[model samples]
Each structure stands twice: as structure tokens, then as C-alpha cells.
Target: MLKSRPNAGRSQPKQQQQQQQQQNRQPQQQQQQQLVHTTSSHYGLEEFFDSSRNLGERQVKSGRAWRTDELRLKSNSDLHKLWFVLYKERNMLYTMKEAAATEYELFPSPERIDKVEESMANLENVVRERNNAYWQLEVSPCATGERPSIFRRDVFGRHRWHKCSQHIPPYHRNWHFRNTQGPGKTNETDWFFHKYREMKRKHYNYFRSRTARYLRDLFRRFPNADAEYIAELHPEFPQGYVQHLKENHVLYDDPPRAATRARIRPSEDVQQ
Candidate 1:
């Protein structure tokens, strides 16, 4: 009687196991599909494309730049998100602009890129303001976390603000450092400085002389013109110099009366 059901239990169990394996794989397949869809939506190729508009379209009007006041009102996280949005927008615009240039076509709404840049600048300024205020309150009044700059003279003896960095000081014995520190107080440098000063002085004198001559001619042409207006317009001409020109310049002279009209004499024949 037991021999009749020899393969029945094994066959039923194998079929059940197969069904269970398929059921387990179904959820995983659905999960994988869902993940792929989410990823595609988040980072799609569509981002590189501009908004739906014809290639020949031009002059698309847009809103003004984001103001610092408006940006300051937003939370840091929101600002961060906005920055990335604007950054992506700028990159897209640049791409579109280059494409238009290559195609010999006009780029629509180029100012939109400028607006984006200005908004980004405003956002950064607001963030920097907050950072500075926080540093002042929690740390020290003068302590901004930014790098400090030192006033240093270049080879030309021009003063410039150089950012301090992690490097050997100018006084160090390093040859590279000494060479880059500029020609300090040598006879050659002193002579060069003297020559530079002399050149600047000559330029100033030449400019002053040219300006004086121009003022002299202007006053001569417009003797009745407002002296105060002239002075205001050309402060480079000193008040005393302008007054002297007004008083002493010959061009300021009034024109002499036209010679009296020649007396008309009637012909002798007409008298007869």
C-alpha cells in the first residue's frame, strides 16, 4: 500500500520550493526597477538641455537678480541648494551660448546668465556676512577666518597687499626666498627709484602746462561764460590762475566797433 505513493511527497515539496524562490525574486525585481527609475529621475540627461524653446528664439525676458536681503532671509541649507541650482543653470547657459556661437546664431537672453551670476554673488556675500558676524561674536572682533594679507613692496617699490602663506620669511637664508623678496635698498634700486620719481614729476609738469594752455584758450573764446562753472569743471586750474587769465588774456578783449559804413555819394549825373 505505501509503495503506491513513492514520488508523491518529493514532487510536491520541490514544486513548493520552486514557487517560494520565484515569490522571493519578485519583490527584489520590483525594488531594483524602482531604484533605477529614481536614479534616472534624479540625474537625467535632460538637465543639459535648455528649456523648451525654438533654436531661433531670441530676447526671452527674465526677472531681476536675487538681492542680498532676500538671500539673507533663507536658511543655510536652502541657500546651498539654491547655489547648486544656479551653478547648474550657469553651466547650461554657457553650453547653450557656445553652441549658438558655433552655429552662427544669436544666444537668447544672454543677460539671464549675468542675472544668475549676480544672484550667486549676492548669495555668497550674504553667507560671508553671516560668517564674519559669527566669527566676531564667538571669537574676536577683528578675527575673520579669512587669510590675512601683509603690506609688501614689489620690485618696482609699489605697495601691494600680499596674502600671507605657509612659507619661509623674507629674512630666511633660502636663496629662492631672497631672490623673490625684491632688490632691497641696493644702489641700483635707489638709482632706479630716483629715475622713476623724476619721470613722474616730468609727466605731472607737462600735464599741468597743457591744462593751463587749454584753460587760457577756453576763457578767451567764452569771455562772458561763467567763471565759477569753468572753475568747477576744471579744478585742476587753480582759482588764482583762472582769475589771472580772465584779467590779463588779450582774447578776452571786446571787438572794436566796425568801421562806420562808407558814406554813400549820389552820382553827379543824377544831381544834374
Candidate 2:
């Protein structure tokens, strides 16, 4: 009973110390809580909207898209920032347009989306041009400097640009590279290539035949139309066929120009 009493006495002070430490921590936590600013978390979300335009505004005047020359003058870092800005603007516009559409209203200045898209395309082309120039100078030996790719027939027999990786000289003898790059010589591939060629041939013939039919109808309807100009549009027409059309037909209208002219008798000049 005496030993148990001393143990209990030690435990009571430890418990009191813990309670005091917790009491001290409570005020610090309370101070931190008090110091924290109570700003709304979504305060920055207004960025996705055009503040200048009212919800019911019929027209929102915006500037033209960034031209290629303008974008080329910008540094890479500027381009990077502009890309994000345009991206965000596009999103904002899309959201606003959707909101307006949901209410069955016309979105203000829909052409703004086109301007944004054009700017984005121009920006990408600028970046791509820069990349191509750098690669040509530093990394690639190919003309485009955009990693040399060969027209490879895939396993599906569709031609795809198969990008080649660079290596030390004498790449031809590298059997492993050759084997890995192309489609395997299998029965399926052989069959596919045959069918693929047939499909391509059919596609080519279909278009050419359609062009011929169109040319025939065009020549029938408007014989006075320039055969040379029509030939320029589709130069595949044989020279003989074009010359035949030029010589035989003059007009598809009711009467030929030669036949329509009223005769003016030469007797008037004789009398004078």
C-alpha cells in the first residue's frame, strides 16, 4: 500500500505538467488562428472572365490576333507567358459563351474565339520555326533539322513518318536498327499491303474519274469557258482532248455567235 501511494504521487505531478503544457499550447494555437487572414480562397477566379463586357453586351470589341512577325520578335520567355495568357483567355471566353448559350442568348463577339485560335496557331508556328532552326544548327543533319523521318508502311500498311534516331556514321550496316524500325515481314503484312495498295488505287481512280465527269459536264454547259483555264485547274486532261474541245465547241447557248450575227449588206458602202 505504501509503494503504491508514492507511485500515485509521481503520476499526479506528471498529469498536472501535461495539462499545463496543453493549456500553454491552446493560447498559441488561438493566436495563430487569430492571425490567419480570412480571405476567400476563390478571390482569383474572376480572371476567367472579360471584365469589360457586360453579361448582356451584344458586342465586345477586341484586338486582332498576334501576327507571325509580331510573335517572332518576342523572346521565348515572353512567348511562354503569352501562351498561358491566351490559353486562359480562351477558357474564359468559352465559359462565358457557354453561360450565355445556356440562357439561350447569343454570345458576344464570337469572332474573338477565332482571333484567339489564330494567335495560338501563329505562336505555335513561331516556336516550331525556332525549334527547327536550333535543331538544324545543333542536332540534326537532315534538311528540315526536324529529325529526319522516312515514309514507312506500318503493320496496317498505312504510310507513316517514322522518325530516325541519330547515331555515329555508317548507319546502313546496323542490322538491329533496320530490323527494329520497319514492320516485320509477315504473311499478314504482305496481305495488308496488297489490300492497302488496292484501296489506294481505287481511291485514286475514283477521284480522277469524278474529275473527268465534272470536266465533261462543265464543257457541255459552258463551251465558251476557257479550256486552257479549266486545263490549268486539272492539267491531267490530254492535250488532244483539250484541242478537240477548243476546235469543235464554241458555245452551249441557244445559237452560235457566228450564226446569230445579222447580215449587213455591203451595198451601203457602194452607194456612198
Candidate 3:
């Protein structure tokens, strides 16, 4: 028991120990570098900065938007990844646009934002389609978890589709405690509705009068214009209104030189 084993406390060689330390350090250093790279890559301000060519350019040509059909063909996972990509792109573009505006420089290829938006919308639609399909196959139709909406009249009597959310049952006395508690009609609301109706009526009358005046002016300016063509063009105008304009506004005169020349020149050329 008192005698120690010969190799029990033997230390590694300096060369071997140093080599081992170097190997361990390599991986740790590599990991640190990778982490730094990842962190820098995700910086929002860096992403928002424009490329050299686009920084001060007036007009930059870009490609079209991602089509719905193209997005539909992608897998859910792929679309999920692409959604974040587009979202980041949109944020970057918005930031760049704001910067450019502040600097009084043109934001080149502004339509890129629109393209990214279109792609994101298509992606969302594809995801929604998949969700609907999954719900139909695995869950009850009513269990899709989307908010149900119904056309309901508000306090002002305006009908709109109100999105319904889970709430306390109607029988609960405190259920109507919310600031937006509904179905309460007041005199103020009635008066507001009355004014809204009156404003709408005025707009309707003004639009009708404008249309009549335009028709009268057109008839006066081009007396020989085809009544049937005019009626076809303005199907919204009553036949009686068209006839009234023709009889009252139009002056019977020879056709304008421009119209006569256009008609006569073609026919003479044909005869020749």
C-alpha cells in the first residue's frame, strides 16, 4: 500500500501536450469566428445598405413578382423559409428607401418592395391553403380556428362583417363591460347617420348632373357623332337622356373638316 505505481503519476510529454492544446484551441477559435460571422450577417442596418450601383441611381430595372403558381409549387418548409427571406428583404428595402429620401437621393428599383410584398402574399396564401386542406382532412370544418365573421348592424345601423372572437357567454352580466359593447343606438348616432345619408344623396345628385352636362357638351361638340355609339359607350345613361341631349344640345351643321377629311380620304383612296 505504501509503494506508488511506476506509471501512476507519469505526465504527458511537452510536445504532445502542446499539440493537444493546439487541437482543442483550433475548434474553439473556429467556433468563435463562426459566431461572429453569423452575428454580423444578421445586423439589420448592414442589410439595409444599398449596393454600390444602386446607391444614387435614378432608375433601376428589376424583375417581376413571384407568381402564385410558382409559390404553390414549393413545399411548406421551403415556403416557410422564403417567407422570412422576403420579410427581411422588405424591411431592408423600407429602411433603404427612408435613408434615400432623407438624403434626397432616388431609391432605385422601388418596385422591388412591391415584388417582395407580392411574394410574401403568395406565400401566405399557399400556407393558408395548406392549413385549410389539413383542417378539412384531419379536423372538423368548424375547428379550423379562423375567426368567424357575420354581417351585423352597428350602433349607427351600418352593416359590416364583424369578426367574432371567443368571449364570455351573453348571459354573463359583465359580458357587456367592454368599451366597444354593441347594439346600443343613441340619438347622436341617428343624427350622424342622417347627415351621412344626406351627404351621400348630394354626391349622387352631383354625379348625375355632371354626367348630363358631359353628355350635352359631347353632343354639342360633335353633332354628327353616332347616337348608337354614344349610347353603347354610356350604357349607364338612360335612353331618354341620350335622346334629350341629341335633340336639345346638338346643332345640325356640316361635319367638321377633320371628320370629313378622315371619311373622304379613305373612300377616295379605295376608289382609286
Candidate 4:
């Protein structure tokens, strides 16, 4: 037979060889490399960046954070899903923010971070409320189904609402608790506690009196305002409290008028 052409039966090109190898790969191997190939707009690490549409935009319009009422309506499973979505969104926003900082670029719509955090806090609070309710219904000894607390001194001698934890022995018997927390009742602590109580009492009294005075003035200024609505808004006050204040304004420390007509009026004597 005639000699074979020089190019006949030659090896396949490098690109064609790679294509054949990829095609011959086992299904398991392909799955291992990538779980599923989808025709999504963004892929891989790009998912964690700002969207293509908003990449260079100065402002991005968005909705407000999810409210507690809205979240409460969702079931546990739905809440779980939303939580992950929000988490991923938070991560993406943070990544973009950090990148901007590194590159001396302005992070657009910084309030997005605040909105995300607020939603997260609301979610946490909702979960806590549900947990507390569940404990109250099924297992709690205390009224709140939570830790019991008392107004007590901290290590620094500062008084606060101290939450008590379960101990093998009573609080008095537990030395670890005592040493970790400050020594409870001594002359020095007693003196400080008394002084702090006095100061707090004075501060509270000042506010209460001031609030009462303001209520009286408002009542006097707007005699026809909805009394029921005002009372509802400031329910801390007794039912007849504002009326009593209006009748006896002098009982409050606030003066009726600091400057009189004689002092503040356009007068020739004052000019002289």
C-alpha cells in the first residue's frame, strides 16, 4: 500500500485530550469535585461580595429589618431558615465592609449593618421569650422560669440585680461564690450602700416631681386635651394625679414664672 500520509492517525490535540479525560471521569468523582452545577448568576466566592448591580452604586435602597411581630408569625422551621439567610447576609455585608476599609473605598449603605444586627437581636429576644414560656409551662419553679435575682453588691461594691446560680450548698455555705463575689455585709459596704440608696432616692424623687410638674403645666396649657389618653400615656401617675397637680401647682419646686412683668417688660427704669 501507498505510504500513510504524515498527519494520518496522529495523537489528538491537548485540548481534545483534556475534554476526553473529563468526560471519562466517574460520576462519584464529578460529584465530589462539585456537589451540583447550577446556572446561577453568581458562583463560589462571588456570592459573598456585593451584587453586580450594586457593586459601584452610591446608595442601595432596601427594606427595614424584620420586626418582632413579623418574626413571631413564622414557625420554628421557618425561623431557622430565616436565621441562616440573615447570617449569610450579615457575613456578606461584613466582608464587603472590611474589603472597602482595606482598599480605602467607601462602604455604601452602612446602615445595612445596623438593620441586620437589630433583626438578629429581635430574633434572639423572640427565641428567649419562647424558651421562657416553655419553661414556665413545663418545668419552672420560679415565677419567671428563670434564675432568681436579688438587689446585691458586686465584686466592686456596686449594687445591682444579681442573678443567683444553682450551688450544691446554700449561698451562705459556698465560699467560692463569696470570694468571687465581694464580701456581702461589712461596715464599709453598708456605708456605701446607704449613700448610694440615698443618692438614688433623691434622683428618683427629682424625676417624679419634675414629671408631675410638667404634667400639671401641660394640663393647664391644654385644658381640653384628652385626659384619658394623657393618663394612658403616663400610667405611672395615679388617675387623679395630674388634676391634683393642676389644682396645687405650688406643691412642686418649679416656680410659676421666673421673670415678672416688672423685670422683663420694656421699661425705662431697667434701661437707666
Candidate 5:
């Protein structure tokens, strides 16, 4: 009879059991559903619709990147929220820059805040895309449009531009005109033309004088050396001048030696 008595407080009451079941089921239901935007703070797009909404002014106050392992532990919903946070930060920074420029004041921390926000956005996008692709077995979506290019007309039919990594549409109305003043002046043909000719003339004269001096010195160095063989080695070289060196014994003598520089030799001595 004692054993048959119901064990006191062995199980929760029916009402309590129901409440616990509801709590567990609620989290499961949330996990099963896709997240939706509760606020359009990312692009500052929601500002136009609601005047009472307070968009925070731009401010830079943060430190360090979240560790990859920490980010990996976050749920998809949390990652989405972080993405919007960074997007909002970028919009705020842009707003501050425009306002500062309009007021002729320095944009405090200007590009720094924007760069930080952009880095976070990029990292988040990469992580999200990787997760999405892994889960769905599909490529991440990217913007599509006309390729980037410089517009220039050639002598032919109509044309469009293309570039290696362009993605924006080419609005012909907004095309930036390059070389508006047309072809530049040709100093290359006229100024450099005469300048280069003068340089070449000077160089030719210098080399010619140097070659003649070398031949004369060669004969003087070896007085009894064969002049014919010397002329044969330097066919374009002046031979008559070297003959004068041999006859004068200019550099051929040693020690108390020839004291004067030799003049340019006649061209007749040079072999054809």
C-alpha cells in the first residue's frame, strides 16, 4: 500500500510542462525561418520615409577586428545584422563628408572611418557569400552591366567600349570628354627634330677627331711597324696622317720624346 502512493514532485505539473514545451518550440521555429530586415538603416534609405527617425551622426570609435573563430560561431542572423551595421556606418561617414565640404570645414577622421567600415563590409560579404554558396550549392550573385572602357572613335562604324573589370552601365549622356582641346602641338617633330640633328653633327665630329688621333698614336708607338697592316685594320681610318707620324717620329721615340700634338692627317692615307 505504501509503495503504491504516488511519488511527490516526481514530474512537473501539466501547465508547467506546456510552458516549457512552448519555450523550446519557439527557438526551433525561429531557426527554421529566413531573416527579414526590421530596419533599413544600412543605406539611410529609411530616413526619407520617417522624419522622427534619428540617424546617428558619423563618429569613429572602435578597436580591433573580430576574430575569425568568433565570427564563425555567430548565427546567420547575427552576421546579417553586423553587415547592416557596417553599411550604416559607411552612409553616416559619407553624409558627414558632404556636410563638412558644404560648410568648408575639415571632415574629421574623413576617409579613415569609411575605410574601416568598408573593410568590415567586405569581410562580412565574403563570409556570408561563402556560407550561402556552401549551403545552397550556387554561385554568389554579382552586379552585371556594360564593361568599363575609355570611349574613343576610330575610322569605322558605331562602337562601344569594354574593359577588364567594368560593371557599371555607360550612360552616354554622362560620358567624360577627354582631349577636349584636340591634338597637342608637335614639339616632338620640330623642336626635337633640329635639336637631334645638331646633337648628331657634334657627335660625328668628336668621334672623327678621336679616330684620327688614335691612328697617329698607333704609328708613333711602333715606329718600324707595318703601316699597310695598320691601314688595313682601320679601312675607314686616315692613312696619310699616320704616315706623317712615322716620318716625324712623333710618339715613336721614347723618354725625352716628341713634345707637340699632331694635326689632323690627310684623308688620302685611309684605305677605302
Candidate 6:
């Protein structure tokens, strides 16, 4: 018995090793069970999964968007888990959608996409708010320098602008001038400005052509239509425009040709 197992250190029995592996896996199995237990307690997660399951039947199973306060209260692990669940559900829905499209059938619960998207948007907003707050408190400014206020003139050289922020340091009071060159004086020849001018010119030309054509047609339709009234109504009309109509027999009627007297009266008198 003492001389015992000669090669005991060399190799363990297969059955023993199998038993040890089972023992090792027990803790992992318990941990997995705990993970499941924790996930089941999350808010709305079960409902989200349920809605996903009925995507083939329902058309409006999407839940409301998550609010920031609620997200802020959630633990990091829970949020992480939720992200993965949402991701999986999205993939599942997308797969079903593609399949339905291929079969030319309705992929029920179309609004689920919108709901998921809204939730994602809300989540991103919450994250951004928290991130900004954290940065402002801890880092003293955004990762990039404080966002500068911006101002710009409209295409028509008009003042139309917005102020982005108000954290200008006293030393950089001249930052605005440094970044923005060229005086604010109106420059109609600027690319956008010129484009706007050209657009206005084309629009005016179109109206002018249309007005002239309409007036010509009106005279043709009713030779004695109101001319002076129109001229008075549109005093801004070009002087040469109305004059051209008068010269071309457009605005005024022509004089009738003179009638010739018959020579019959003289002939009759001579015969008498």
C-alpha cells in the first residue's frame, strides 16, 4: 500500500479529470444563473423582448422612448446589458424585415424601428448630457476648447446669425476679428451674395416677360381694353415699355382711313 501508485504523479484518470472539469464548471454555471437573475429584474426589458417576439403579428408594439433621468439612475452594467439586448433585437427585427421584403409580405410592427430609434436617440442625449456635465466639472472645459460663438451674414448681406456659446476669455476679446476677416460692409459680389442677386434678376426677368406677354395678349383679346388704368396702376413700369406699346399700335387704336366723296352728284347736275 505504501509502495502505492508508482506513476501517480504522471497522469490522472480520465474519469477523475472529467469529475474535476464538472466541478470547475459548476461556479461558471452558477455565475451564469446569477446573470440571468439580475437581467430579469431590469425595467421594461421583458416587455421589449415580448414585443420583439410578436413582430410578425403586431404593427405598433414599439415602447416609448427612455428618459434621461431614468437612464441616469440605471447601473452601468445594466445599461451595458440593455445596449446588447437592444442590439440583438434590432438585428432580429432587421432580419425579419429583410425576409418579409423578399417575400413581398408585411413585416408587422414597422413602428418598432422608430421606437428603437427614439430610444437610441434619447439614450445618446442622456449620454451626451452626462458627458458634457462631467467634462465641465472635472476638465474645466470641453475636450476641444470652449465652443466659440459664431455670427454670419445672410446671403443677401443681411444680418442673420446665432450665438453658439458665451465662455470667451478676457484675453481673447479680439478673437472674433481674428477669425472673421473682411469688414462687415455689404459686399454684393460675394459668391453666395452674387448667386442670390442672379436668382432675383432671373425671377424679375421672368415676371417682366410674363407681364409684357400678358399685356400684349390682353390688347389682342380686347383691342380697347383698359390701358391708362394699367399704366397708372403700375407706375413703376419702364417709360419705354408703355411707349413701345403705343408706337407698335398695341395700346391705342389706329385712325380709320378717310372716306372719298362720290363724283355722282356732279355728273347728275351736268345731265340735268
Model 5 bad stretches (over 4 Å): 1-60, 65-69, 132-272
RMSD per model, one decimal: 11.5, 14.2, 12.5, 11.4, 20.8, 17.2
lDDT of each: 0.81, 0.81, 0.76, 0.79, 0.58, 0.65
Q: Where does model 2 exceed 4 Å of error?
A: 1-56, 91-105, 132-144, 165-184, 236-272
Weakest ten-residue segment in model 6 by summed lDDT:
180-189
TM-score of 6: 0.35
Q: Per-residue lDDT of 1-272 in model 1, one digit per residue for the tens?
A: 59758688779999999999999999999999887754334547767868776457768878999999899899999999999999988999999999999998899989999999999999999989989898999999997867788887766665678776676544555667656765456777778878988998899899988776777777787877676776787777666767787767785544555655566788988964
lDDT of 4 by residue, 28-74 (tens): 69787797667656588888788889877789887899999998998
Model 2 scores a TM of 0.56
TM-scores for all candidates?
Answer: 0.55, 0.56, 0.62, 0.50, 0.29, 0.35
Comparison by TM-score, 3 against 4, better one: 3
The candidate with the higher lDDT, 1 or 4, is 1
TM-score of candidate 4 to 2 decimals? 0.50
Query: Following a full C-alpha superposition, what root-mean-square deviation does model 3 have from the true structure?
Result: 12.5
Candidate 1 differs from the real structure by a C-alpha RMSD in angstroms, to one decimal, of: 11.5
Residue by residue across 106-149, what tens digits does model 2's lDDT show? 89899999999999999999999988888778877564655667
Error of 5 at 90 (Å): 0.8
lDDT (Cα, 0-100) at 265 in candidate 5 = 80
